[model samples]
Target chain A: MNLYRAHVLICGGAGCLSSGCKAVLDKFNTELKAHNLQDEINVVETGCIGTCDLGPVMVVYPEGIFYQKVAPEDVTEIIEEHLIKGRYVTRLLYERPASGEQIPFYNEINFFRKQQRIALRNVGLINPEVIEEYIAQDGYLALGKVLSTYTPEQVIQVLKDSGLRGRGGAGFPTGLKWEFTKNAPGDQKYVICNADEGDPGAFMDRSVLEGDPHSVIEAMTIAGYAVGANQGYIYVRAEYPLAVQRLEDAIKKAHEFGMLGENIFGTGFSFDLEIRVGAGAFVCGEETALLASIEGKRGEPRPKPPFPASQGLWGKPTLINNVETFANIPVIINRGADWFKQIGTEKSKGTKVFALAGKVNNTGLVEVPMGTTLREVIFELGGGIPNHKRFKAAQTGGPSGGCLTEKDLDQPMDYESLVAAGSMMGSGGLIVMDEDNCMVDVARFFLEFTQDESCGKCTPCRVGTKRMLEILTKITQGKGEEKDLELLEELATSIKATALCGLGQSAPNPVLSTIRNFRDEYLAHIREKRCPAKVCRALLQYSISSELCKGCGLCARNCPENAISGEPKKPYTIDQEKCIKCGNCLDKCPFNAITLK
Target chain B: MAKANCPLPTSNLSEILDKYKQSPGSLLEILREAQAINGYLSREVLQLIAEELGIPESKVYGVATFYSLFKTTPTGQYIIRICESAPCHIRGAQDVLATIEKTLGIKPGETTPDGKFSLEFTSCLGLCGVAPAMMINDQVFGNLTGDRVREIINSF
Candidate 1:
């Protein structure tokens, strides 16, 4: 193989792709060819570099210089100055939001330096479309090791020792799940990779599939070997078209490489894999519901005493694991359980990938150890909340998650601790909130989601969520009564106990947790008829400050409801009765007169 | 590829139906592919899929309505899905949505008179890093402001 002096790794993950990384990629190639550096310098489109706020992000190899928001226009200066002339492009380097201090190296950047990538080891490093790149990164070696040497029981023992739990919400022991399926009485057992990631703020699974599809495939194939199963299926979300495509390509290529098809390593243990695309349903994230969807039915959850281990798809014993869970299997096989155990906390023995988004300055994917403090993840790694805003809260899990305030920042992020703090590690979506965000509105938004996505098969999840949403909605609308709070608490408690599945069981968490943390905000909305964050429109009343209003008639002309009226060079007053709260007058006013109280 | 009114050609639908006819538990995939050709799964198209798969029409329709991605009614050429999830909500998705609605002279679940655009609220497109995001067809646009929303709508 020919060696290249430089490697340009441009982020091609969903975040950067949406941010127009493709144009910059094309420009890099064009400039590289123009300068006759195409052969000498390789331009590789890698996965998410984890700083999504500075998207279209790139990292130059050998030097490790990290650049953000890279445009096609910036490619020339980079190629001409950095690649050819050996001088760094200072303007493109990542600058700290608070201090404006530039950090040039990728390893030195706070966002990535703090992360301990295990499942995500190959994500941003290898080209997912090519199998060679994955193989070079020790991809199929674990499968080769497991097939060549380790017995089925031995493989299961290694996984059990590794203490890797499922990353798909519930954090069940993966080894136990695999062992149960292996021990279950069935002639045709199946291993499933649940890629139906429905959590709203989380995209870690999608990133894993898109960036390193082979990792999931190789891991699933290893799982099939360990669990004594000959067939496997990956049920992925249809919304993730890129992930599905990459998985499809990876599976076909794995076949050609003799890593996936029948009689692997001449061991006579035949295994095959297929991909099932899910029609959009949030309930499908549940294992039972996901199994039903794969069987070409309406995705709905059933009670799980007769779990998938004994009775699963088509009355067969099936071992199902999440995409992130499967991605960890190969690593455990390659490096012994001891190496994996050294990284994380006692109970949660691995790094968790978080989709750090919302008000944070550095919004993207970050994988940190299990015991990392919320404060470290937010303030140090995430670059804190943007625009000098005080950190209000961080909504962990998803719609089912609770809000973590300043008090919870110092707490270690683990499965037990998060649940004790009124939250769960539900797929690792950490959405930060600041002063401008309303807790009541945030609760209301999640309720609207759970209510809409509820399968309606169960009365409690379907109906209970709707009622809870109604009360929350009433509170936001400034029509809430004092009795509404007691009613919301009672309903939330019952919904947690009586709901059919995980979706309904955790549906009321955001509301309950928010009320527990920010009851003052809720009380202000209900009793004072004011939104503390000025977020709820119904509670917000628009008024014009007489001192600031110049009376140019701009506010009057722009108001669709004709709410503002005044004469020239005089103070303008907004008619509250006529105002629809559309904020047209606020946007149109030249002077800073309009305010939403 | 007919507009909201006309019946779609069953020839392409039959090909999609026939390809997945033998695959067990492919009703959703078949319906999804059928919609790709017809734009929206018409009653006749649903009947065709049901008949081809030997499943009841009600079963096919049940599966179709169960998932949000399948559209029974005809949408405009472009389906603009604005994510209303909490992540996007805190990032000013409301304003971006309002701008789109005002620009198109329609609300969510409504299409333009010329069949150029249809607005809908999606839970999350997983583009939260660049919050206040929307997906038109498969392309995602993020970090959206009101002026950017207008510019995107006009471009479409």
Candidate 2:
């Protein structure tokens, strides 16, 4: 047990790694030792610091001073002026995107202030790789308490009181789900953590695993005790090597501390954990499909009737929960259900972590309470659309979720509200879109993903999505007809109804919601072959403006297709027939005469 | 789970097979390990895994083809997986992809003549914060533009 005067926590999440936080971390270590403040000042590499857009982020505590985009060179300055001399490095402090006001502390910053971090409490605060740090932050205390104090039924009762729903998207009541598994007649049951976060824009689960792996391990251990299961598996995606490595390390550390494995906390309870790496299958996110994949079979979904609670892996009851869902378990146990229930709405309790990205000014992992409006999450916390672009829509739930429009801005982001507004609370990957994004393309983009990831075991998903994709492709290529829109709607309806798994059923959500909200965009593509946002390359035709064109001939020389020709000191003209719509001329044009429509 | 002995079991195919020997559901893990060792799962490797696991040859082959990660055909040393999911699509993934193709002189799904790079599109790398991102083998490159992608390919 050691106490430091100040701890400098650097974000070591994947987002920060991409931004080269490793270099910044090494510099802090080297510089701190150089200044002989290594022992007094603790430099810790923690997981994601939430504000992912501004990576290489760090927070120094006891003061909790926040720094963003802290480079290697900036480390020496910070150690000299801030840590040693005790002066705030104003230059490295987080400046408000609009006001240019520097907020020195993390809690005062709009992004951190607005966020309700329950699942993400220790993410940026503690070193995930270190078990001692996790224990120091009260990480695995719940496991010890649950094992020693509460009965299995009593544990389930606590979850029911908390009203924690499945954060994996379907919003099934967590308590009831656990009770079902417990009640299911089986002694050799299993507890599984669904870390197979398949959503494209979503990385919150990965961040959690990278940031606070012990939390999930503790939660799963608690789940095993409640469910009377001795073994657990965390199915992580192969794409996230960092998460897998962290979880593996954390699991081993848990074993070393007697938090996991036989007779945990000297209670008659015993549990073991394993990591099952998913081989790039999006469909495996489905519980049944995930089980099958873990069983060393093709990661395809089977029709659900024997819902995992009763008949799961090897005909035994299995309590399967997502990484986020599991992350909440240890917290709910430590804080008590009454404390947890007070935080969120009646139906959806606690906060949801969202990987907010795309056209939003501030793209990061945001965790807001259940009733937080999309407007606050987008405008207030996200810093509005980037480059002052008019906010068009914000996409949630990835391919399975739908696009939410301006009308849904004030709508509370809960299970029911989001579903009523044409989107479901998916794994919470909120992607913001501006006026420049074409709604038709957005729909097509999501559709294409679902279509590609379709497991082909089911017919409707296999063939139907392909047909819808064909029509969408035709529309994008300026080859759509009036009947195609109706056909798309027809296909979307049937696929939603007939598709076997949740993937196929919710596959058309993006398409249907886009059509419902932006029918005009679809109509424009179908009727006039015009892309309102000029995103469809085939529908775009670039022309030189006579007034603006200085006859620079840059467009002519740069056009790979040799489509532009003009005389010196005269307006240029593009030969429409010869133009390939590559937009090469547009990029190279110095006069800014070219405009696409 | 035999996971402790060899975390990935990349070097020896027989060791992976023996580890999860005759297990009910260990095909995916074995295939992944075999692929890691051999670069891509060859026909002989698939058959060997099937016989070792007591699963039918066809079933082993089916599992291999089902997963997008398990490559049946050979690929270049550097498998550049550019994300084609909605998040990257909105963030100029197409432009970044085109730049890679032009620089490498190879289209998507085609290997470079010298066996240095094989370009392909994957569903999502889950790093949408840095959209228009790609994963070259294990290392991730994000916030890509034409110039950045070109520079990356040239350096590779």
Candidate 3:
């Protein structure tokens, strides 16, 4: 392939796709053809560029000119000005959030500058839809090496030496699990990919799978070679339609290339893969429960010890790993164990992929070396809190993780560090909370998720989480008692101890962590019947301030509950009992007269 | 104990296994084809697969159920799925369900009105952002308010 004069790379990930990246790609192609630069300029649709806030993002390679928030209208100017004249489009260049300096290079942005891409190395660089693009980049070379050269034991040893732990919440030794499956007494063993990502504001696995599916396929094949498994299943949620489609396509191409299937590389080792669409069951994330669901039963987790590695599926050994974990496998094999081990902290090696979302200026996927501080991830990489709002907390590990307050901002983000700081790295979902977020409401929101997703398989998870949710609910509603905080802590500990599965076991993390860090906020809610953020609706009363009220009647007319009851020109009084606290009246109040007390 | 029913001939099973051995992502297709030939994906079929592939029965069963499209249990004629995503909830899908109960008088996860439809609530139908979506035998209906639900049911 001849090197083109210029390579125009467009972000093809979900965020950019939703923002019409495909249209941008099409326009680029059309404009190139129109300008007679089709042969000179190559338009390539790549994976996520990570600056999702300014998408659909595009980059001109060789020169590395980064363009932000490009639309269909801006395509002509880009082609005419930059492509024709070799001049950069200053308007399209990303302006630094704080400094307002136009950044030309993609790597110069704070978001990319702080990130250490290991698992997400291939994303935004390769066209995920093409198989050869992946293979050319040494995609399945690790699996090839493992299959032909190393034994299963050697592969496991390499993984162990790499210090690669599970990125899927528990941070258990990935090699140890593979070793267990290898040693387990089973004529049949399986490799399962846990892509049923249920965490809110988390899409790291989905992004990886969508961006570089061959990495996962290669890793799984290597896993199959290591664990003596012939078949692999990817239990992806049906919601990730694009990721699923790409995976399916990749698997087909892999078979066509003789990379997968019987006698792969003529070594007499056979492995086949299949995509299994999950019906959005959060409990199916648990390996045992995932196995049961794959067996055509209700998705519910069973007890461990006879772990999935020992007696999984229909009663055979099964090895399950998340997409991000699998994405890291090939790199570990190719780069060598010591190379990976050198990247992160002594305990946690390599990089972690986080879905940076919620009140952050740069809301996208970020991969950083394990021991990177939360402050760096938030203020530096994430471009600080949105709207100049003061950062209150950052919620990690989704519903199963905890809230980290401003004081804990300097804490290093790793398996041990997060756990020591009263939070576990639960699937690398980092939701930044600004001053606008209510601590009690935040706890309640997570509790609501856990409560709904609870499989009802265990007493503690089912009943205890519900009870905790009730306490959180009561506190948010200003009906909480002074003893409710004590009750919450007690119930949280009990739930953590007594829950059968990991789902239940970590269910109380949000509550426990929030209460530990934001105890004063809870006290204010219970004691003073006040929400410091004024977010809790029940504790707030919407009153039309006499001075600000021009009696526009917007509030009274838009009031769904008909709570506001005064003449048009006079100051309105909201009937507290009639107000359902929906905030419609307050939203519709044009004069800003409606004040929440 | 009664002898376990063997669903497929050993020779046919071996051939099927050999055909898919070199095929990547042939697991689901093979299982579906095997089930079509044998009425269901039986333990005997799975065991034969294990023996041929040098894997275990538990692993086979695990792969089968992980994908929602693959059914281990035999289903009735039609699958009536209800959308239970956020938008559907906001549009009073619960009340629409209650009406379904009153009309057919059957709860979700049950076959009703002469076993023609098996009602099961599913996640967002992609139309969500647009409320109250439900699928009946692969046909999707969206923007269903509570009152319009009965009309939909009657049409089905």
Candidates in order, interface RMSD in Å = 0.9, 1.1, 7.7
Q: DockQ of every model listed?
A: 0.81, 0.69, 0.06
Winning candidate number (TM-score): 1
TM-score of 2: 0.97
Task: Categorize the docking of model 1.
Answer: high
* Highest-scoring model, lDDT: 1
Q: Which stretches of candidate 1 lie over 4 Å from their true place?
A: B1-7
Score chain A of each prediction against the true chain A by TM-score and list the results.
Answer: 0.99, 0.98, 0.97
Q: For residue A35, what is the lDDT in candidate 1?
A: 92
- Write out the backbone clash pairs for model 2: A295-B25
True contacts kept of each: 0.76, 0.75, 0.02
Report every candidate's CA lDDT.
0.89, 0.88, 0.80
Per-residue C-alpha lDDT of model 2 across residues A1-597, encoded as one tens digit per residue: 567899999999887787779999999888888888777889899998877778779999999999988889898889889888899999888888778788898899888899988899889888999999899888789988898889999999999999999999889999999999999997899999999998978888998999999999999999998888999999999999899999999999999999899888888789999999999889999999999999988888888889999999987999999999999988899999999999878788899998888998778898989989999999899888878789999888888998899999999889889999988889999988999999988988888889989999889999999999999999988899988888889999999999999999999889899998999999899888899998988899999999999988888888888888889989989999999999888888887888888
Clash count list over all predictions = 0, 1, 9
- Mark the regions of model 3 whose C-alpha exceeds 4 Å error after superposition: A588-590, B1-156
lDDT of 1 by residue, B2-68 (tens): 4665568778888887798887888888888888875788888888788778889999899999999
